[model samples]
Target: MVRPKEFDERVALTAAMQVFWEKGYEATSIGDLTERMQIARPSLYATFGGKKELFETALRAYVELSLTYVENKLRSMPSVKASFLAYFQGVIEGSGGSNPDFGCLCVNTMVELAPHEPVFAQITEEFEARLTELFRKSIEGGIQSGELPDQLNPSSIARVLTLTAIGLTVTMKMKPSPSRVEHVAAEILTLLE
Candidate 1:
């Protein structure tokens, strides 16, 4: 007897994610989400519960989506070193549109809420850990395949890469450009090489 809802949930969620990315969790109002998502409050509540819940979903989605993007780039290149080079180059290139100034949502959230909120700290920590793990795996792969020197410590290198990414994301928000992002990425790759 009940009719199904009509709006595209994924699109709305992605929009909400963008809004949250631009404005931190605490600063984003219901009106902001409704406006950005093109949905009424009732529908938003029915689909995503509330602002907190929606923000959590957005954060998780951002992490998953970003990880997938990085993974694909790292896996597709001819060499592991090249994979990372392209990946970081892409970061500096920005999204190639408006909102280039919006940095990593997870990092922004960490800066805004992690100090006061344990939940955010956990999310931010997980985000960093995942990046570190991804870098570690890629470096390990390079070592196994003879693309990199065996004596190099993958863990330390990965930590450094992760830190570089964090720093790049932060810097991009202030002034995002291909030259800047590439410069940092290239310098970081120097360690890998």
Candidate 2:
């Protein structure tokens, strides 16, 4: 009987993600993935099927990691306003870290492949929907708690914030200046009040 794979799946995926995130889907070769993941070609295929499948897996992994942290900040923070701030602050900090300046995997993939790939388009749509829903909930909560304007339309405002955040993520890749991101974030938070 064949033994199960020995290496950590998450670690391999993370390594693969960093490569894909840095180079994008089309630019990333099988050789690059194997080199970055430090696994043999057969091991990679055995574990992740193939290049396309591995890219999808990496995208899903990135989404899960990123969304979990955002959700936690939104749920645990003392106030909706603070929660929004914390969420964006996390993005700024995460993007600025020593890791590749890949912006966001979801955003990068959406921009690069969504036009030509229906599956990626659907994934991008879901990502946006989830982010919009999170902001909508927070805005609704803020309104209930008297932190936001009574007239604020939660759905509309949430869409605006979601798009703004996506714009920021993409911008971070081109110009990863912390001060500029912080300035833009300040303006975004002001909308909540």
Top candidate on lDDT is 1
Candidate 2: residue 188 Cα off by (Å): 1.0
- Candidate 1: TM-score? 0.90
Could you tell me which 10 consecutive residues in candidate 2 have the lowest summed lDDT?
92-101
Query: Residue 99's C-alpha lDDT in candidate 1?
Result: 46
For residues 67-97, could you state the per-residue lDDT of candidate 1 as single tens digits? 8777888898879988898877676666423
Encode model 2's per-residue lDDT on 1-193: one tens digit a residue: 9988878888999999999988999999999999988888999999999998998888888877777766777887888888887777666666434242577889998899889988888888888899888889889988998988999999999999989888877776776655666676667898776
Best by TM-score: 1
**Total backbone clashes of model 1?**
0
